[model samples]
Target: MTKETKKYNKWIVILSITIPLVVAILFGVKIDAELPVFLPPIYASINALTSIVLIASFWAIKNKKVKLHENLMKTAIIFSVVFLVLYVAYHMTSNSTKFGGEGNLRIVYFIILISHIILSIAVIPFVLITYVRAITNNIELHKKIAKFTFPLWLYVAISGVVVYLMISPYY
Candidate 1:
């Protein structure tokens, strides 16, 4: 591995570990007083924006616009990070909104929510590894991993919006 890739590997590990742990801890925490209750819509919009950016990034690479693709991917990563921060903050301060759908819809919502949660966690490492490969100029490896990463990442993004929509009425 290149030195650059090695340098990022440590960060990848640290972020992959820390993000979920912190989010899990914050998920259980609820403040006694109310704060500004704007995070849900903002983070949901971020997730929708991320899905758009991911699709645009894919199109950029398909047209051989490598630099554009890189920038868009970077933006997507930033969106994800911002979304995480806001999501954790919202959960920490407010109660979790439960899904209020009926029987079949509730089941469907849970399925999507479960898959989104698991894949959202999985996508973090894949994203970091793909980003490291790209930055290190390992185009072959980057492309290989990105083929898997893109769909998973997109699903996580879109599902986030869906999950929010399903639960928003209860919030």
Candidate 2:
């Protein structure tokens, strides 16, 4: 590993550990009595935007627009971080809006939700690793990991929007 990669390794681990723990803690705390009631839609929209950015980044790379691809990917990462912050904040202030759909739809929603949650967690390390590789100029390894990271990240983004849409009515 390059020195640059070593420098980022601590941050990757810190973020990977902190994000889920903070989110979980915040998710259980409700201060709806004090906060405004407008964050869910906003954060959900961020998720949709993140998904779009991810697709655009993919197209950029496929067309050999390396600079555009890099910029878009960085933007997508920022969007993801924004989404997480808003999501955590919203959950901290408001109760979780449970899905009210019954039967097949409920099953489908749960499947999507479960997978999204798992992959969202998994993607953190993948993203950090891929990013570190790229920054360190380890192009081969970056490309290899990014192949897996892209789809997982995209699924997490899209499924976040899906989950929001499904549960919005209850909010």
Candidate 3:
């Protein structure tokens, strides 16, 4: 890695660890306040939008529309950040919503939820590294990592919406 690329490695490591830890700590905090809106649906919609953007990004890159791909990928990242903020805000203000689902559906919901949660955490570093590679003009390395990052991220985005949809009725 060039010095420029190497410099970002520390930031990527810091963010990759800090983000999940901060989110986990924040999940334990509750603030007594009435939010102006119901956030679950909003965040869920953001997740859905992120998925669309990710697909668009893929299509753009496949077509050699590099600028378009860059923009779409950035949008997807922004949507994800917005979703996280809103999700954390919602959780801080409201109580947890239990899944009213039972039997096979309940099992299925948990399975999706578990996988989604795991992948969401796991994708952080992949995303950061892939992004760094791209910004540093390390196209070949970026492409290799992005193959894994793209699917992992797309799954997380899609499954977030699915989890929200499955649990929304109880909220």
TM-score of each: 0.94, 0.93, 0.99
lDDT of model 3, residue 18: 96
lDDT of 2 by residue, 3-38 (tens): 767779988999888888888887888775655559
- How high is the lDDT of residue 152 in model 1? 99
lDDT tens digits, residues 5-51, model 3? 77899999999999999999999999999999989989999999999
Report the error of model 2 at residue 22, Å.
Answer: 1.4
**Model 1 RMSD, rounded to 1 decimal:** 1.3
Model 1 ranges with Cα > 4 A deviation: none
- List lDDT for all candidates, in order: 0.92, 0.89, 0.95
Return the candidate ranking by lDDT, descending. 3, 1, 2
> Candidate 1, 162: how far from true, in Å?
0.7
> Is 1 or 3 the stronger prediction by lDDT?
3
lDDT of model 1 at residue 10? 94
Pick the winner on TM-score between candidates 2 and 3: 3
lDDT of 3 at 7: 87
Q: What C-alpha lDDT, on a 0 to 100 scale, does residue 114 get in candidate 2?
A: 96
For model 2, the stretches where C-alpha displacement exceeds 4 angstroms are none
**Residue 29's C-alpha lDDT in candidate 3?**
97
